[model samples]
Target: MNTADMKSRHTGGSLRTGLPSTAFMLAATAYFLLPLWWLAVAASKSAGDLTTTPSLWFSDVHLAQNLQELWTRDDHIYVRWLLNSLLYAGGGAALGTLLAAMTGYALAKYDFPGRQAAFSVILASVLVPVTALTLPVFLMMSQLDLTDTYLAVLLPSLVSPFGVYLARIYSEASVPDELLEAARLDGAGEFRIFLTVSIRLIMPGLITIFLFQFAGIWNNFFLPLIMLSDQKLYPVTLGLNLWNSQVIHDPVLRTTVITGSAVSILPLVIAFLLLQRHWRSGLAAGSLKG
Candidate 1:
């Protein structure tokens, strides 16, 4: 074919490929964002206005009023619930990431007795339904007098088999064996090598693991419902459920529910923005291999 015809064919192929992918991306973005946009709009409306006004457009813009009402209600219990959620998600993610990273690193870098068995068990745990395990966990906590305590909910949130799996995959792919050997030649301890080299290389994957665990713990309901009876210890999910159930008697609470729901999602959004930078990092790991 002539050069001009060849260029024309290539242009056509690029257009055909890029157009569908771009359209799909736009559609997926809208699919995820539409509900959040509605929540923000609905939260701005009054109780009566929420139902009467358009679903995706602002009505009274009473967001500040709604926040104040939500705060002042029942001696600022909503604030307590928000704090509880932060603690559960943040603490769980931090602890879970560290443990998962270490376990995964060990599995990837070392060959020990029962190593395969350990990974197999962790993979099996990922397949098990978290809801199904909630009852047994609750029973165990009850026997240990841990039920209705912060530890009951927080402890379970700290264990994430999926995080371990992801960690192992990232560790093996990103942290070269040669780098570890180089560090060992310099007399760096195993823990020190992991801290300085492997961890730095696999940070993006660790951020992913942390985000997964954080979202899981933040949105977790069944485990908290089964484990906790104390309202003071309730995370945002359970606390919001209590508020939602109360809407039958006090109608004004509808706005609070919507507003609180909108507010509750802000932390996750902020966390994603903060952690997204790490996702682009560690591309230089292979280049730095000794």
Candidate 2:
């Protein structure tokens, strides 16, 4: 074939091959976004209007009414639940990420005895599902008289084995021994070296760990269900689940639940958006090293 014809044929073949992948991605995006779109539309409607209106389109906008009701219902219990969720997710994730960074740094950099054994234990813990541990954790918390308290939720969330594993891998790659040695030669303490050199290098990994733990704690249900009996102590997830249960009897709560769900997702979305840069950078660093 002539060069012009050959080039044209090759371009056409490439376009044909790319089209399916492009279409598939678009379809998948739509599928995932469909629920959120529905929730946004539903949140804008009253309980009566929800069934009557089109699922994806707004009608008789009652978003302000919903917010007022959401706040006034049970004397602003939803607000309390939101605060509880923030405390559990935010505080727990912060502490957990720090612990993970320290533990991972130790595991990666230190040549202590039983290092391999300790890591093996962490790996085993990671393999054990959170659901499996819920009962034991509840029993332990009961013995400690911690059940139904914020600590019951926060304490358990502060130890993420997977976060530790990821941090260790990232620390091993991102933090250099030479830097530690130089810091030590300059009379820096181990903690100082870590804070100044290693920690800065692993900031992206720490942010990833924080975001992961935050989302996990925010969405956690079973553990809190088993631990907390006090309605006031409940996070947004558990509170919403309770609302969902009551919706069968009280149809008006259906709209409240939907609105609450829509509202609950906003903080998580904002969190991801804020921290996504760090997450992306961390993944890139991991890939480059790997």
On lDDT, the leading prediction is: 2
RMSDs, each prediction?
Answer: 3.1, 1.1
**For model 2, what is the alpha-carbon lDDT of residue 117?**
100
Provide TM-scores for the models.
0.90, 0.97
Clashes of 2: 0
Q: What would the per-residue lDDT of candidate 1 be over residues 185-277, giving only the tens digit for each residue?
A: 999999999999999988888887888888888999998898888899999889999999999999999889989999999999899888777
Off by over 4 Å in 2: none
> Which residue pairs clash within candidate 2?
none
Residue-wise C-alpha lDDT for candidate 2, range 82-197, written one tens digit per residue: 99999999999999999999999999999999999999999899989999999999999999999989899999999999989988998899888998898899999999988888
Off by over 4 Å in 1: 1-21, 280-290
